[model samples]
Target: MSTYLIGDIHGCYDELQAILEQVNFDSFMDTLWLTGDLVARGPRSLEVLRLIRKLGDSVRIVLGNHDLHLLAVYAGIVRNQLKDSTTLLLEAPDADDLMNWLRCQPVLQVDNQNKMVMAHAGITPQWNIDTALQCAREVEAVLRSDSYPILLNTMYEDMPNHHHWSEELSGLARLRFSTNVFTRMRYCFPNGQLDMICKDMPNKAPEPLRPWFTLPSLIAENYSIIFGHWASILGNATPEGIYGLDTGCCWGGELTLLCWEDKKFIRIPYAGIKHW
Candidate 1:
């Protein structure tokens, strides 16, 4: 069974289909692992969600920052950011079901069988696999509960009470910290605080805010991680086992997929869908 890991789709349904066909993804045998951000920015966010949902158990997804923003918008916690496409998803009849399914998904997924960690954004420097998984569970619990909207309402904040974890953390303070790491992380200050605002390349990430993977704390963990968030960096910021899949399909860039078994990249160029 071939397991394929795809980068940020960002509502590029046509590209997603083309890539799957190129790989000849066998629904029954070949597994599909999405690097998240499955919707928004492109013209077919709703179609993308429906297609993946139809794939059922064969598809594994982690939530990205955009995905979380979508949920927040739906819950009336935030305004819609996907003016181009997400409104279609929000207006669809199955919007409730789709949002429910999306929120149920983990922000961080640990695949011991595949020997990798999957999160929309990269993991924080302070957490190892076990701690990271535990933190993810905390956020997952909040998202899946009736109080989910409460978290969404306050989720869009910079950094947190602290960059590093502490056993004393509780309530939204703890939840926000973990959620940001899993969905919005990239660069961080040397003190371990995430640089949540800079969506630029590592070189442009500003002083004291170095790429997350370059930190000694995170590098020491040394686990294979597959993530897609910083499309600006694309696949250039590879630090050994870390892989970036989001090639900015929403911005006229290509959608790339990585074959897990052999680590091969299968790229499908965008079909000229004008986002502007």
Candidate 2:
């Protein structure tokens, strides 16, 4: 049995399908681990969601920032930003089903047997695998509950410089930070301060802000984390147990797939630019 970990799909269903076809995916013998951002910015968001849903237990997705935003928008908690491009999903006949499936995804996924942890972004230097899992479950519970709206209402914005996982924090906001840390996080200050506004690669980051992958911590040194969402830098590359799957499929870059067991990579060239 082979386990393939795919980077951020971002609704590039055609590229996803082509990559899967090239890999000769077999539902009976293969498992797919997706590093979130399963929808948005590209065409065919609905198709991507449907294909994953159809695959069922054969696939697992760690929630991405885009996925969380979709849930928030669908729940009437947040609106899209200016660059939003998920009209295909909104118009899909199964939009409700797509949203439901997305909300069910976890923020952190780990295969202890393989010692591989997957998230949309990188785990904080402060969090070990266990702490990360616990926090992810906490937020997952709220996202899955009927009070999801209340949680969503409080979900946006950056968190306190130092987060301690408090019960007083809104569940949606909790989800937001967790999502940010695991999926959207790129750089943080040396003392473990997150700088959310910086989107450049670590080399160009202002002094004191180090890439999460380079943090000198037990989690960084101990576990193998497979993540996407930082397409501008580590595109379709695997280095030192860190895999970046988001080859900027939405931005005319390739869509990459990595086979977990062997670390083999496959890529499908971007077809064209998508306006919405």
Best by lDDT: 1
Stretches of candidate 2 above 4 Å error?
80-83, 159-176, 220-222, 236-239, 274-276
Tens-digit per-residue lDDT, 1-276, candidate 2: 999988888888899999999989998889999989888888778888889999989998898888888888888777765465676677678888778767877888888788888888878777778878888888788778787777566555565642433445554555666656765687777766667878876667788777877776556355688888898884533448676677787788888888877878888887857563
Candidate topping TM-score: 1
Provide backbone clash counts, one per model: 0, 3
Q: List the residue pairs that clash in candidate 2.
A: 120-183, 121-182, 121-183
> How accurate locally, in lDDT, is each candidate?
0.85, 0.77
Q: Model 1 compared with the native: what TM-score?
A: 0.95
Off by over 4 Å in 1: 81-84, 159-164, 218-222
